[model samples]
Target: MTLLGDLLADLDAEAAELRSVVAGLDADTWATPTPAPGWSIATQVAHLAWTDERAALAAAARTPAGREAWDAEVARALTDPASYVDDGAHELARLDPTELLAHWDAARAALGEALCAHPSSERMPWYGPPMTPASMATARLMETWAHGLDVHDALGARPAPTDRIRHVAHLGVRTRDHAFTVRGETPPAEPFRVQLEGPSGAMWTWGPADAAQRVSGPAYDFCLLSTQRAHRDDTALVATGPDAQRWLEIAQAFAGPPGPGREPAGCADARSPHG
Candidate 1:
């Protein structure tokens, strides 16, 4: 299989994992608040659905009319960058739970088809920088895992960490510069070693082994940190240098404004899920 095919397969499996958990949810359960402030389980799913649709549109913009539609989306996003995403999520979350799930199912399916049909050499336009199809698929997988973690937390499910997170882990490493750039800081001039222990007892690593700056930790914790799903203090990550230490405090794989990371696990208000 091509790299895009491999990534799409991984993305489908990741999305399915989250879907299985929510498939039988009651309306009230769907409305359950997640750790993200003011976002419900349904909202999380809606965001995913909306994003998939947008990504599909990007993939399909090969003609003049289609490119106009894509350009319009970019204009709209730039109009009120702060509220564009939240508004989409809020609008979609208003649907009946069944309808919402159906929409997400349809959207993700369309995304897969569109991406597969897209020319691999052409970049997919995005809220962030343009990305190759494989890069886009990796981003989708990362978000699915991250938002799924939010839902899992809301439901009190302690899912076992898996190798699927390797995609997210890789993004986390690749986005070290992005993490700094989003904060208006320059990325370090030198490479940093990242050595993570994945669930399958394999070490997933990146960067030069001899680099003085390094981050060493379990892959699971690093994913949570990268997504801002868990507070840095709550993770088992150890940073060897100041630059590496700062990266952990602001690591974010997703594109957008910086997120207000979760409170430390030991905080009084964090005693329960979604607290």
Candidate 2:
């Protein structure tokens, strides 16, 4: 199966797992602060719900003209992050736990169904660039995993890691040029090779070392660092090449403003070796 196919399959499973957790939460627990600053468990779930709904809209409207329309619609649909956050909090707070879980479940299923209908090669317009359907699905999975991690950490719960996050790590490595541009630097010529360790204790590598710099390290580390879900110092990645190292320093898997993220506050729960 294609990378996107693999990611979506994993997403389906993860989404279900998230629902199960949320379903079991008490109202007090729903208001508990997630690892993400200022966001409660309910808000975290709402953010995912928003993303899933947005992705489904993007996926279903893949035509050139349709994409333009979709962009305009979303632009109109969302006000600003502050306002969006407020709306999300309100929506989640108002729903019963069962209804909230159902809403999240349905939104994810919609995204998954749309992803299943398209191949990786099917082109669609993302915020600034065109992406294959597979690329889009990978993006969706990455977002889910990142936010879900917030929920997991807040509850002091540990969810099993999966190979799906490699897609996120790859995106972070591949977006070095974009990151440079965002930083007001000239885009570098060399592409960077990415090597990360997956959750299964397997090594996953991508890119060409000859044509690009090399980004080699544990997959979970790179994924966490890139998503701003974990701090860079908390991970064991060593970017050997100059450009590769630079990419790691400012890597971002998601497209948006730079984040105010840091490594985990404490090293007490540093990653333990997987059996």
Candidate 3:
């Protein structure tokens, strides 16, 4: 399977997993706060669904002019930052549990179809920059994993870690420079090595081990902390170099204003099925 295809499969699986988790949730559960400070579990699902629709729209636009139009639509959606999550939450809340799953399944299928139709190398306009269809698909996977972690935290359910999360992890590592620049920090000149603890508790390294700067740690922790799925303090990632550590300090894979990005206290003993 192509890289994009593999990513789409992961996306489909994660979305379905989320739907399954939320399927039988009572209204009260939907309103329960996720690990994210202000957002509820309902808000997380809504954000995922809304972003999928937007990504599909973006992928469908073939021509440069068409891509431009799609970008304009995304810009419009951001004017009321919370509207995307709010609309999704309202829609999900109105549906019976079964209907909600049906909607989620259909939405994911449509998204997969949109991704399958485009070649990964086909460039498309993104909210911040131009990216290939493949890159956009990875973005979707990253969001799914990030938000999925939030749901898992809220339910006190520990999800099994998967190396499949590597794609998102790589995205986070690659975006280190951008993350730093977004925070008004000087971009590093030297390449940084990244090591992450995988699902099986094995180390997965990215970049180079002996590079001037290095990021090394358990994969799950790095993934969680990078995506803001969990607090950095919740994990045991060690960045030997100051630049590498600083990058983790404000690392974010998603595009938007800077967030709290700090490691919350008591993350080690926080609720988790795996623990």
Candidate 4:
């Protein structure tokens, strides 16, 4: 399979897992608050559907006008800034739980088709910089996995970790410099080594074998850190150098403004599953 094909497959798998987790939810379960501040289980799925629809529209646009329309919508969303994601999610959440799930199913299917049709070398416009089809798909997978965790945690269930986390881990490593740039800091001139143990017991390493700075941890914790789902103090990840430690604090594999990450494990209302 092509790289893009592989990414799409992984995304489908992740989406499927999430669907299964939420398939039999009762009304009370759907209304349960998740780790995300002011977001319920239904809100989590609604946000995913909204994002998938937007990504599909972006991927399907093949003309300047088509792209411009999507860009205009994105600009409008930015105007609201704080409420962009929440507004869309709340609007969609107004639907019945079953309707919301159906919407997500259709949106995810359309997104997969759109991504498959787009040329691998072409860049698709996003909220931040344009991304290759592979990158977009990987981002979608990361979001699904992260949000799914919120749903699971809200239900007080812990799903077993899987090797699919390798994609998120790789994305985290690749976005090391972007993490620094977003915070108005310069990335270290020398690359930092990332050595993580995958769920399957395989070692996944990035950067040089003997770099001065290094990050070492379980792949699951790394993914949580990269997604800002877990605060550095809550994770078992170890950073050897100052740069590496700083990166841990601000790591974000997804695009957009820096997230207000959840507080460390037990401070007030800090409710992250990973925490």
Q: Pick the winner on lDDT between candidates 3 and 4.
A: 4
Full-model lDDT for every candidate: 0.89, 0.72, 0.73, 0.86
Identify the candidate with maximal lDDT.
1
Q: Which should have the higher lDDT, number 1 or number 3? A: 1
Query: Candidate 1 on 13-122: residue-level lDDT in tens?
Result: 98898999998999999999887878899999999999999999998788888789999999999999878988999899999988998999999999999989988888
How many residue pairs clash in model 2?
5
The alpha-carbon deviation from the true structure for residue 230 of candidate 1, after best TM-score superposition, in angstroms, is 1.1
- Score candidate 1 by TM-score against the native: 0.95
> How far off is residue 132 in model 2, in Å?
2.4
Model 2: lDDT equals 0.72
| TM-score, model 3 to reference | 0.85
- Encode model 2's per-residue lDDT on 135-165: one tens digit a residue: 7777777777787788887799778877767
Q: What is the lDDT of residue 33 in candidate 4?
A: 92
RMSD of 4: 2.2
What digit string (tens of lDDT, one per residue) describes model 3 on residues 1-275?
97887888887787777778888888888778776655677767766766677777777788677677796887776887655545655666456556655666676777788778877777766566877877888888888888787887789887788887888888888788778887888889988888777777766777766797887777777777767656666678887778887887888887765666544765443421110
lDDT string, candidate 4, 138-213, tens digits: 8888888899888888898867999988999999899888888878888889998999999899999999999989
On the 0 to 100 scale, the lDDT of residue 259 in model 4 is 75
